[model samples]
Target: MEPDDMLQTVDSVSFDRLVLEDSGRMAVEFMSYGCGYCRTIEPIVQRVASMIAAEETVLRVNIAADPELAKRYEITGTPTFVMFLNGSEVGRTEGPAPTQSAVIDAITRPFMS
Candidate 1:
């Protein structure tokens, strides 16, 4: 798939649906539209997601538009990634990071053997 195809930016409603009905494991990045840090790491997240898109679902949710979802996850920062497995949260990583590798590791660790 194309690189951009690896990630999806979803709305509050869709986010809920994806989180609950995703067939396999998934990771969602909670970011605000005006967050500089979130913008800076957007490409990094997309690239890493592309690398593992075959095995996982990667998404980005605009926290500003999804306050309730953010509250449910207890997200306090931009660029927070919450990973779900079988419709249940399994792991999470918060804040912006220096590189995609570290963030990717953090988001995927729970499903790794």
Candidate 2:
């Protein structure tokens, strides 16, 4: 599926359902409209998500749009990445990811077990 189709908006209420009940792997990209780093990493996130199969999903949450989620996660900056497996956060990275390989590595590392 396309990255656009794979992306989901995560909020306080829907967060549990999207990350937990499904028990599916997810990559959450936390970003803001005004963040240059977020914009720069957007395409890399999309490409990595697209390269992955249907079983895995990459979700984009706008910190500007969802301040509640940002506060909940203690997100102080843009371009933060969180990987979830079975509804719990497994790994996270802050700032520009640099490349799709770094994203792919973060997303799949926990599953390597």
Most accurate candidate by lDDT: 1
Per-residue CA lDDT of model 1 for 1-113, tens digit only, reads 33545677777777768776776989988988699888788778878888888888888788888888888889988889888998888888888474977877877898885
Global lDDT of each candidate: 0.82, 0.77
Tens digit per residue, CA lDDT, model 2, 16-92:
78876768888788888698887687777777777886768888788887888888788888788777888788877
lDDT of 1 at 19: 78
- Name the 10 consecutive residues with the lowest summed lDDT in model 2: 1-10
Candidate 1 contains a number of clashing pairs equal to 0
**Model 1: residues >4 Å from true position, as ranges?**
1-5
The 10-residue segment of model 1 with minimum total lDDT is 1-10
Which residue pairs overlap in candidate 1's backbone?
none
